[model samples]
Target: MTDTLLTEPDAGNASEALHEDRLWRDNGWTARVKKNEDDDGWAVEMIKDGEAEPALVGPWTMGRDKKNPKPLDTGAFNTLVKTASEVLRRHEQQLHAQLHKRMAVESGDATIEVTLDIVPDEDDPYALLTAFDSFGEQLAQVKVAPNFKLSRASAASWVENEFRRPG
Candidate 1:
């Protein structure tokens, strides 16, 4: 006996339907359309699998037709999901790389100076990047983890905690 695996066709119509409905579904992300509570525009919610809530949420613009979206389907949803996820992933990687580069730990004679690079993390709006020194001291910290960011807050906090001027 031979095992046969079933595969679904990549249909444009299906994708169109989802796109019309303002829903995008990808590998592990789903972008849904919702009305903005404070304004008349629409909002997008990116939900990831296994997450209790949306991974990201932001405003969305109307389509070329300048009309509200239709019901979302598998195809259209998938494409949007893929695009949004890729954008977010790239942004996160950029932030991580930039943070590592900008937050340098330099020691001169007896004192160490700290710097902070801040950038926005669209996916994790509330989270920040922080770097520490060998003595568990913070060098820099940033609230937003964008393509280029540092954790100056963490560094300052660490310094304050570890090194206090004599009164």
Candidate 2:
């Protein structure tokens, strides 16, 4: 076997370290507390590595004296990470919901699934409405306005009306 060079990971660096001004860094994320521009209070900004925008930014707790912002600690860091991660998760869920809408409608002797997938465009947004039979076979696809609303009644009517492309 050929000789190979290997090095152990930096286990000691797993925890966040306070740099200055309530700033903490660790595990590819940075938590920063700064004076709020609008008021005398403080704000916290959590930024993930390699991203230009911050993952989360919110109010920071004041110290026990209630004059300065609280110092960065491991507990605070973990809470910030959790809150930032939740923000990212909610954003993704909202985006997914906006892009795709699905419903099931009863048709003749079977139930069909209808999905409206929005394709966003700066100039003109549009959506594709697709129908699938009970066996998951594509029945039809039609393009419509991005804001097109679909309901069970509408889907049922569409399936009953010969799958015509909606105008």
Candidate 3:
């Protein structure tokens, strides 16, 4: 076979290994060195526990024979776990940025900070439009359509209309 696996179960599923030449389970992550389908080289995939897809995948090193992948040890597994966790963290940050927005709107004598946080509920997706004063006191909050476009002109109009729920 082009690939070799050594395993049992994972922490999320069980307390063991699963597949690949060198499979390791620790800290809610599993690193598996698998066969690279594109070339004759080897690749490693880092999968987080309970996730359907791998968090990171990259090329792996060859052994002394230059044929098989280097066996994964404690050090390598720890590094993979750190890298995978960072990847997940960055992904979460990006998603948060996409779903939430904040901006400052000059309303009369005070500057109002407006924020739009989107809730992507499969059944009832919506957005919360909230306004905070310069002193960080919440002024008003309204539920709006998830597809509401949060822009400078729109925010100004909303503030001008006394923070009415967007139509």
Candidate 4:
């Protein structure tokens, strides 16, 4: 739905995104070939737009003379973009796993699932501690510090305390 809000590419920047022998820019990604610092070989780096660092970098094949790096072709550029996009996706998934957690705590009458979802806000980072029953009904929810670590022991303690806000 939000795709409709995206603005068309600027004609003025068309020249900047054009492909070169050792550089290519498209699909919000830039692939640049440079000399590898470790050896006399070459390397290609793929950077996503608006990112300060390259998402992926690896060795590049040499030309016929075995001196310079091969030109960045459309096929190679597409492969680099795919690999870099996967890297970014995996990183995001790892971050999400680290920020969100869930545990089942046994109570007197039944089992309750407790979840902690962290909000890494720049100014006021926080987390939502929520409890749910087997039927998926939200029992309670409270805001807590972002650094709050959720564990089985803590979840049981929170349940014992009547789902109160934790420190």
Per-residue lDDT of candidate 3, residues 1-167 (tens digit): 22447443444554454433467766777888878999999898888877778999999999999998898877888888889889999999999998999989898888998999999999999999999999999999999999888998888889999998877
- TM-score of each predicted structure versus truth: 0.36, 0.78, 0.87, 0.83
Error of 1 at 110 (Å): 28
lDDT of each: 0.52, 0.80, 0.84, 0.84
lDDT of 3 at 57: 97
lDDT of 3 at 163: 91
Local accuracy of candidate 1 as per-residue lDDT tens digits, 1-167:
11121122234333332233555545555567777778877676776655557656777676666665344567556656676678778878986765444333344433445543443456653334455565767655444434332345544444555533212
**Candidate 4 wrong stretches, greater than 4 Å:** 1-17
User: What would the per-residue lDDT of candidate 2 be over residues 66-91, giving only the tens digit for each residue?
Assistant: 98887777888989999998998999
Look at candidate 2 and give me any clashing residue pairs.
Answer: none
Report the poorest 10 consecutive residues by lDDT, candidate 4.
1-10
Predicted structure 1, TM vs. truth? 0.36
lDDT of 4: 0.84
Order of the predicted models by lDDT, top scorer first: 4, 3, 2, 1
* Candidate 2, poorest ten consecutive residues by summed lDDT: 1-10
Q: What lDDT is reached at residue 60 by model 4?
A: 94
